[model samples]
Target chain A: MEEEAKAKPRNPSGPRLCCVCNTRRAALKRPKTLDQICRECFYEVFEEEIHQVIVENQLFSPGERIAIGASGGKGEHGLLSINLYFCSVEDSTVLAYVLSTLNRRHHYGLDLFLLSVDEGITGYRDDSLETVKRNEIQYGLPLKVVSYKDLYGWTMDEIVKMIGLKNNCTFCGVFRRQALDRGAAMLKVDKVATGHNADDIAETVLLNILRGDIARLGRCTAITTGEDGPIPRCKPFKHLFSKCISRFCSGVHQGFGKNKVVSSLTIRNCGLQKPRAILDIIKSGEDFRISTSTKMPEQGTCERCGYISSQAIDRATKVIIPGWKWCKACVLLEGLNKGLPKMGIGRSRGLNNDRKDAKGNDNAAKSIESKQCGTLDF
Target chain B: MQLTLEFGGGLELLCDSVKIHKVSVEPQNGAEMLTMKDLLTWVRTNLIKERPEMFMKGDTVRPGVLVLVNDCDWELSGQLNTTLEDKDVVVFISTLHGG
Candidate 1:
């Protein structure tokens, strides 16, 4: 050990002090600002930044009923859910201890509910929901679970078995968006708050650009979306970084662990530089200006379900397609019920036939001219 | 030197779901002190049973994996260059699991 010490080069700099407090030893370096801060100071700055975002954006009104979308894991996403809820409340003292005392405090005036989607992927979702259920009791929030099996009569496990893994995400993604809306509508909440952090928004911006989805690209960076829909949605964590969310989640989970309530909050990072790049993408998305002459798709209600959609409705099948005016859900259901799972999937002969007629008859065909199977809107 | 390593955020899945391991490690190539860089190699070799890529990439931990030394972020201690002491508690939490 002495010989090892001799061979090792001494660190040029000793322990540095926190940049914010200027006293305590620095614990971590902030990626956004590159500030070296201690744990206590980091907590303060992190929570304060979130509070500022909420106040500046007016994310919620005092009496509005809000539904928090939660998925059980390491609790990072759940931490965002709880943090946003707590931040909206007027108690600064309780913020630090919110996780432990959330069940007992009811003075926030806002009705908050935990909404989770069960994809019915067997072991994966089932195990995660256990953590969600535990969090429900721990936080004393009412839990509402909406499953794919109930909403669409198809579990992901069954869907994967039939569709294989190739485009399973497409089915799951489309189903989940509708399921969340249905769940929120069932709860009768005034608004829905999802834990979509900065990184997530950035990724969507990049994806929208890659797919040349100018409409979604413009709306993806907005803090609140679908305000005109039945249930308006907002992302309170839209400005917060994923790393901070993970740290906060772990901190809260550890704090509550002594009381024997395990926190199963799981977080996935998409790499370090990726988030910075994502922010740049969001900036680019914000600065984008679509030419006025661009023929944008007209927003219309799904003829069958009355949900707002931008896709053309199919006249014959009553499904949403290029020449049709039905939503993807209605079309997929029609396909499934009629034993034609491949009906709207890829570039099938049926779709080609529809396109031929669409080109001849309608101008809306241009909107979906390049649309492929599984690439339709959620 | 003897050390305690803890894994969280589904990283334990790579190691048979074992969250913690106590093991002894020595500096490689006749070095006197063990830095986090060496410790990572040791972990990849002995601890990670499969999918080593999940834990490491190009001689360092894959981005998004948080490393803490003695309850502090490894960034404070120079990351891979932070030298280890006896009985130091190191934590490896992967933030790569689905939220």
Candidate 2:
């Protein structure tokens, strides 16, 4: 093993030099630029790019309390949170390590906390949460875990049992969004940062366009979303690529810094979508402009939960349930509790007609259309 | 040549949940040195027990999967053409899991 470690430069004839520094041997080929750079130069450029994005977009303000939405599952491709703390150490490791170092190097006086949502998936989330716990200790950041069972009285395992594999992701997705917001609220943070890279945003853009969601398509590309909501959300990695994030996470896992065990998984096959298509979708989303004359849903607070929404009730059903206007989340919970899984689902009018006997409102109901499973609703 | 292969980022799930494997790989009949392409083919045939599609696409690994040879990103080397020596450590990590 020692010999293998020392024998990294197999070709001794002419060593490949870092394109940027042009002195040290190249460590990795950058995916974005395909440039072969030494580790030091890569560290400089990578951090510099992220710093530029944060500064240009004004992602954060000094002294703001930020909650990092750390899922602790897939480190890079999955929702991983980047927290800024002050540590005066000069480390060349990736984001997490660099951010910790920057805490001291740059004195970014930000109170960062890790807020994780436990979806209560037995084998999957259970295993990943252990990694999140390790990270909590490793980074010396306090962690708050909000479970689906605790928040919604249903775990993903239970939801899957009731709804089967077909639309279980819908429940999980909607619940997760609310859970993250609630978790952030519990943390009392000013802003929430999620580890959503450029690819995820591009994918959201494509899905929105495909679904004809002009409102979401217009706002999906924004670095920070839901600013008007209870807790504002930001994506520091919005301009960053998934490949770069994965490389950085993998580097940290491979013992690049003070982290001991490989507590995070960095590799993820984010579907079969080509990189070119992802970039194009993001570009198209940026260029898209919704005309003012077009009819768009007006934003309003849900009567039941007081959450911000473009629609008064669940977006799927136009019929206002006699007394209360519940948000999509409350409506989904009502369906789950009332043993009517079809409520607030596809073609809400048909389902509403069947349930009219319960409420006795015979008004014409329009189908509000439901989003597909595994797609971002925002 | 003998090599130590480490699978991570849920890649072990495809290979009976085994993280590490020490195996011997021989170059093709006329070839003198073993390149990553040969090792990848050998791994696909010998190591990956299921979901070979998740690990390999076309000739190389799926776009999201990362390969490191001797603790260095394979891209620094010639990727598929990266030559391997005796007792080298190659890591395959799939970044395709839930976040």
Candidate 3:
């Protein structure tokens, strides 16, 4: 296949040899002036229908900092990386890719990587830090290595083992999520992008739906820009399938990050076989589209985490709902309101009158209607 | 056979007791008559504003509330729709998110 690619005069437009299975042919190609990756690799990326993803949600605008969680895994093939850089070449230059990795002891990969043109960390996080250094020279962009232990209180190995896989998924996810944002804050980057491949997105959607996680299931779109939260994160690969992404990634040979054929996940080593891992039970909805399976629920914040999670404030805000029993944002918010009136006005707006209006009514319908500060129909 | 039902948010809004099943006492008394779905429906229709979208879809649902179907998180059984037999202990407890 290598000889074939070299032997034949590259038709500025023909499919090239695959990046992973060099035995097969790629399905796509890059333009002569754009990047140096093959077409097949292009499809394997969330880059396939990028315009649709962006336009549907109106993601990009002037002065937007697109922060990317560069896992450097099977998710971020060379084609997707370079293409993403090229797409944002002009107006959007502050591309801070958050390298969310685990304890090197866990042996996930990318040790002491140069995050920038030549920037590498001295001790812990040296490998991934070094990769970011190399990325700077390779793409001539800003790179930041985000560490998880500093912010989340545990490394992947420590967390997975202690919490025991099933529940550890949430721990790993929450830590890495916050870790990226904290890193982005350090770098002073605004928006963020992540290489969450199709498989990852689909699995999450399925899991959310299975658990009746109304909030997560609905908002897991290809491009979810966060509002009422810090640093909006957008995903361009939310809709494509894994096979296409794999097909597209296979043709990527040079220039950008590697790790194309590794497993379609970063949680491979956590040895997940637990009851809550979702991967075990949430089967892929073959021939299913995001529109068909999801019913985007209303948007609200977790009174604990303050992150853009399910926007359900009613049940979650109940007295019996427990304070620590909310989203990370909700929990934080609840804590902040501790020792003070839970609801009423607080220099911003007053709801004491509202609470009084429904007091003693206990009628679900009337209370709901009055709670809204609007007219009641039913 | 008096059972206590400690709901999440709305429990405070209701009286100390309500006649759920033939048992004219607390929710715990009619543990067999009540369910996660039933409790949710009551909350949706009488207490809260919206609805609990995915309450029971076989094994797909995670038990959000700490339902002691005999003093154990329903995660012990397939959550959400776990059925209750005779003398089954159904106690609605609290939930825990993160730190």
DockQ of candidates 1 onward, in order? Answer: 0.38, 0.41, 0.01
- Quote the lDDT for A226 in model 3: 61
Winner by DockQ between candidate 2 and candidate 1: 2
Error of 2 at A57 (Å): 1.7
| Candidate 1 per-residue C-alpha lDDT over A90-183 given as tens digits, one digit per residue, 9 for 90 to 100 | 1111222332233234334667787778878766665556665666676677889999899889897887777665445445555666677788
lDDT of 3 by residue, A100-153 (tens): 111122232322222111111123234334444655665445566555445443
Candidate 1 regions exceeding 4 Å error are A1-14, A71-108, A254-276, A309-324, A347-378
Q: How many clashes in each candidate?
A: 22, 14, 57
After superposition on all CA atoms, what RMSD does each candidate show versus the true structure? 8.5, 7.8, 22.4
Kindly list the per-residue Cα lDDT of model 2 for residues A174-293, writing each as its tens digit.
Answer: 677777778888999998777666666776675555445566678878878777777777766666666666666666564222211111111123322444555566788999988987
Candidate maximizing TM-score? 2
TM-score for predicted model 3 compared with the true structure? 0.40
Which lDDT value does model 3 have at A236? 53
User: What DockQ would you assign to candidate 2?
Assistant: 0.41
DockQ of 3: 0.01
